[model samples]
Target: MQDYLKPTEIIDWQHPQVLSLARDLAGDRADSTAIAKICFEWVRDEIRHSCDYRLNPVTCRASDVLEFRTGYCFAKSHLLAALLRANGIPAGFCYQRLSINDDGAPYSLHGFNAVYLPEWGWYRVDARGNKLGVNAKFVPPEECLAYQPRLPGECDFPEIFPEPLAVVIEALQAHQTWDGLLKNLPDRVSVLNS
Candidate 1:
């Protein structure tokens, strides 16, 4: 739980801008759930999905995502987690393996957040930035993620990580552009077991 709330190099909740924004989002809300929902919606609606918009720089860290106003799904999750953690709520990362083409093969990891609400314990939310055919909401006890794992090799990973996976960070850092990141997205979850 402490790990979930702690700022890291990637999560970076302690960063000045992130901290200020977190306070702004919370904005007189005393309930953890309300704060979480506000933070979740802010990231989902305010931040642009890098690949979806074809934006550049391939941000990984939370602060970078907020600064750029655009990021891939993984980077967006980082910002959401940071905002939640900054507001004194625990948040963790979750992933799903899905076919990039929605058919088969070329499966890549999709990242999102699982926040610990006092009433619901742990709840997952996807801040991947909604578009036509993709809607992710912060309704506790009932998840409405951007995509479902329906394809042959797709799966919803059970573990909730305190920080973004190393592979995800690596991919974001390695790729300089949104298109590059899209082409070389990380696919393996075996590292989680290792």
Candidate 2:
């Protein structure tokens, strides 16, 4: 609990600028779903999507993305998932393969998030900023969870996770560097926002 309270991780919880926000926001949420919903709203609406910081992949942390104010989808997932975890909601990463109409990158896959909703079970959400860096137009609907990523056999998730993740798993299986597998999309929003 103390670890998340550090000035760095606070942004991952919610809007850092709000006065007297925590006691009210995190204190009385009716259920885990509600808390997760608020978290979804904040990340969904407030954080802008960009590819900038994600290039290295390893540097991602909820604290870094929230404090710096920009990140790729995975960073956004980390931020939201960390907040959900901090708030006592069990959450984890869920991703899928999505190739661009025109292939240009290394892997033909995309990443998103999945949260344990208790009564409703685990659900999905995409926090990636718009492909063109437009945050306003990309709002995730509740139905997005219908599209889920493959889960690992070791993972507590109900389904099986796919190949892009398999490349990561194989490297991990070989005791190779897991950090090399992640992609940092790109971003300039954090700079301009700051």
lDDT top scorer: 1
Give each model a TM-score. 0.98, 0.55
Instruction: Give all candidates' CA lDDT scores.
Output: 0.94, 0.47
- Candidate 2 segments whose C-alpha is farther than 4 A from its true place: 1-27, 52-59, 101-106, 130-142, 145-194
Candidate 2, residue 65: Cα displacement in angstroms equals 0.5
Q: Give all candidate RMSDs, comma-separated.
A: 0.7, 10.8
**Candidate 2 residue lDDT tens string, 70-101:** 55565566677667656666665655543222
